[model samples]
Target: MTELLPAAGLTLADEILLAERLNEFVQDREAFSDNTWKQLLSVMRTGSRWASEHGRSFLPMSRADLRDYLLWLQASGRASSTVSTHAALISMLHRNAGLVPPNISPLVFRAVKKINRTAVISGERAGQAIPFRIGDLLRLDAQWSGSGRLQQVRDLAFLHVAYATLLRVSELGRLRVRDISRTADGRIVLDVAWTKTIVMTGGLIKALSDLSSQRLTEWITLSGLIAEPDAFLFGPVHRSNRATVALLNPLSTRALEDIFARAWREAGPGKDARPNKNRYRGWSGHSTRVGAAIDMALKKYSTAQIMQEGTWKKPETVMRYIRHVDAHAGAMVDLMDKYASS
Candidate 1:
């Protein structure tokens, strides 16, 4: 193959290196897949093409070039948030340029503050734990069945474990059968070796064990999951002959989001619970995880204890989920009254 020309000192080989770095970052953070890296590369290529057609090939790109490319994406009907992904990728390219910026010292700056949407809502600038409820979860269980598809049983099991263990959709989707251990009584136990949260100190990070072991066992036995350990715990719901095992691929994260959207619709809204006009305030698959956290909190589990079940490293992330469920707002008042009076 002919060598691709360089853009901002990134040859096709350098782009590959950056893609590797992107993969490591995503995997380490338990984020999206390698496909996201390809999207970022496409963004770079688009910017390079614009520059080339305009006769501005240079070793380092100007901020103007980046801004123009972002404008192009916006004009193409991308959302502000999606356009921001391209901006972030471009920023990473500048950081990886291997040369220091003019008059700037080479020093690393750690993330002192990540975005805290929950904190903003509570009239504070700190992250709030997302809130989730058991009722909401039962409703989601119903929504999974609404698809009326073949893998309905398998999909239900997947949704149950996700809600019961509060697994991030990414963790839930990536689970291999080997990641689960079966107890003598035939219960399913999950050993989540990786999670989205970062534990800087590292030794003895908390985990969820057998949260839904009993239910999982029932689901597996009913679904006839006798596959080998290396098989995917969840796969697409398709049909096949006896000679070929009909296997399902892991659902994409985007697909999971759509599932939640469908659930929110089926659950509908309380008569007076409109978030804005016709829009309902709180509902989604994320509700599965956040709702579990809120249920535990309302059950009087301490904040730290809730973090253990939710597998949240920081109280802040847990707090975000807490706030999401707090949209109803009465639970906290009762919680405060009971605790404060005590």
Candidate 2:
């Protein structure tokens, strides 16, 4: 008896069965974070709808179909990066289905290139959040220190820890009480289990400043969460009738953004100033991470040091956050000043 084999592999009784199993394995192995998955799903849905409207199928979409889709996206006022993501998502779908991806089409490539050139010529770029400066954090801390309000204490702790660790709002939201520990040096260390980077090596450790640790301790004591080790570190605070803290539930990303917005408003000049309408309009949950990177850059930390602290695998990503700061305080600025002033 002779054994049948697939074209690329060893002998198998049924090649179709092997292909099916391989497809399933590939699908299972490709995992994405919740937010990332949602974004990819959105892209997929948009692409699929476009394909359906054009009487085309997504699995074996042709290069011409993809080109048309890209043109459609551009016509619909999608950003170049967003259109690129959609193309990438379509390519991923094709690859998962064991078909050659249509991403290498010259027309699609030219479309993307044209969009980039147009954006640069028009001075268009993505909006960035205003980094939360250290001075702002200090001012907020002073105001919340003697307020004797549980929510204020929690906000103070949140702001300090956020600036210290540069944690994303999602990672901060997932923090559990048990994930934190006090070091012998009296600093608070957080064991970040879920982050965008550390999915394999268990997790990474981030340390909080002494002031942040003290504020955290006060919040925990006041919130009565010291006994509940399994509770979330940051939870909801009920302010309907009276201020009451809830620890059993984890804080949502929206809630974190609201907290940051409120802090920005309070940190500004007047009580009537609207956070969304003010200079702090772009400030959001990601501001802490951007601010921390800029702070490190202003302090003369090397690129490698900033990358390590931010847990960024790519130097280019880190550069994006600090480029503006570098423009003001970089070595070139000092050199230029020395020559120009003389």
Candidate 3:
């Protein structure tokens, strides 16, 4: 099941071919859970590049070599989490090929531990995306009125959906017109077909607010996506404001990020304010997700509720998103403030 792919000679097309082969293999055996072959290939390329530079082979990777690769990744200034992801990807590829991953062995596992310890000692924390919370949405809603431009309207709807569903970028991109529906009780439900963590068999459903429902309806009507049930929910509007590029073509990840940034920038009444400008620049695809989770925490929502809303598998992962708020807003801090006042 192992692939002895050329270390240095692998190119972009080769990566694609290998990924496709792996995908076909997955279809037959159902051995791997990940459907994100492109992301896997991207990680594979990093290992391949390193292997090429070091005159080493990546596919039939030795445990010692894998350990060194992790160390090299950290030494080259990659973040601790990022280094772990690199190692994890390699492990995934090995598992996909029915081989035991080197990462599980003490030889390579110790390297990962050391990397984590180093980061902790250096006070290096994993960076969370800048959240676009309820406040940001309200400001945008107040200032970004009117649906004269379809893209403007669509972007607003997109932002609302992102916040309400707490969906990852891939989930957001995969949304189709048919996925949004109104229940008999007038509740808007957005059905998530699959997620990064688990395959929902098209059963995972999320509730969107009436506010979000209205924005979505407006966008659907203006963009005429309702007529095409299978069309991408968030298609790009061309520059002329004439029409979308194509109904079937989904917006690329970069395009989605750009739309978010543009919407964020134009949300402010000033439109030229330094704060808004910086937020637009700093925000990423996960900003709304981080923002929504933090907003829930501030509202005293339980970690369990937040996990269900965001489709997170682990409480620790959810905590990571809202930990900064928790770090400052604990009961101890409130009592300390009360003591100061007394």
Candidate 4:
């Protein structure tokens, strides 16, 4: 469950080997439910893909091939922030392997800059997209309105908890009934055990609105899971009497993406408005997080406060969520109000 930095004494090959071992550790734990191993595998596969074409016979990689690989990632639709994470993984692999020389030189620095710039330009700086918005939620609720009471309640609960908590899809999917609790002031708070940036310490968030909480309560009561606090909150709702264990697993990443796609289709202008295969699209699963941040920013939440609430470790992380359109609109309103005739 804990993320470890690469060891100092490791070589490039050793780093790769250790990464594989760590992945096995994660798979064996079974305590965690997210796709940590899958994401790490993705990074390793990316390294392999580039290393195949760009690596020298004796060297783990070539500078020119590295540059070209970065360019390929950028053009192939990897986000700037994600690309940077991948770059960090790669750089760590090298540095931990003692690939760099002790004496710094301009040439070495420039080569480092080349790789870093590739990450920056790949949309790595843009960070992850936020979750869905209110408008999008309404559209989704409407789309699945006729399914049934349980399905309706479940859909609303998914959207509400996700947006209200700004939870990653894995956290949302893995949520248990006991994970949520009420504070002294009657405000709802969530005790998120696992997230992208956490190992143990939990964060708190005040109730932004009441509708989400109500939907959550309704889903719990209606789903007959109040007795099974430790069990998955969302799971197969319409299973037959003899359904197997494998048939009723909680939501998967692809399922969540498909849900987002359906909502987006209805929210957008046409069938082509479907949000997929792109990071910074008109909408996606993370749009809820993005929309929540935008909502907070418009309400005058400082970047520092926003970062804390969003559980981001850095201010630049918060900046990445502040989309250009929102920035321009805020600036425009300020200017128009200041210069307008009384």
Q: What is the C-alpha lDDT of each candidate?
A: 0.55, 0.76, 0.78, 0.60
Q: Which 10-residue window in model 2 sums to the lowest lDDT?
A: 1-10
**Span of ten consecutive residues with least summed lDDT in model 1:** 105-114
Residue 143's C-alpha lDDT in candidate 1? 61
What is candidate 1's lDDT per residue for 59-127, written digit by digit as tens? 355544555555666566554545656666665554544322211211111110111232235343322
lDDT of 4 by residue, 1-342 (tens): 434332234567667765675466556645433454456567778768666665421124444445555556756776555655665555544443345422133543464566567766654443354346566666766665445556556766777777777777776777666776776755556667767676665444335356666677767666777667676766655543221122246677777766566555556544444434355455556777777777788778888877766678877666767755356567678889788955
Model 3 CA lDDT for position 203: 65
TM-scores of the models, in the given order? 0.57, 0.84, 0.82, 0.68
As a whole number from 0 to 100, the lDDT of residue 7 in candidate 2 is 24
C-alpha lDDT (0 to 100) for residue 95 of candidate 3: 62
Candidate order by decreasing TM-score: 2, 3, 4, 1
lDDT of 2 by residue, 1-342 (tens): 323222233335344654674478357755767776677678778888887888975546777778888878878877777888888877776565555567777877887787778766876576567778788789888888866667777788888888898888888887878888889999899999867887866798998888889998887777877767887888776673123444556777878888887887778544543443233464589888888888888998998998888778899988888887757766898999999999
Better of 1 and 2 by lDDT: 2
lDDT of 4: 0.60
Task: Give the runs in model 2 whose Cα sits over 4 Å from its true position.
Answer: 1-30, 240-249, 269-282, 328-342
* Number of the candidate with higher TM-score, 2 or 3: 2
Candidate 3 local distance difference test against the native? 0.78
At residue 20, candidate 3 shows an lDDT of: 72
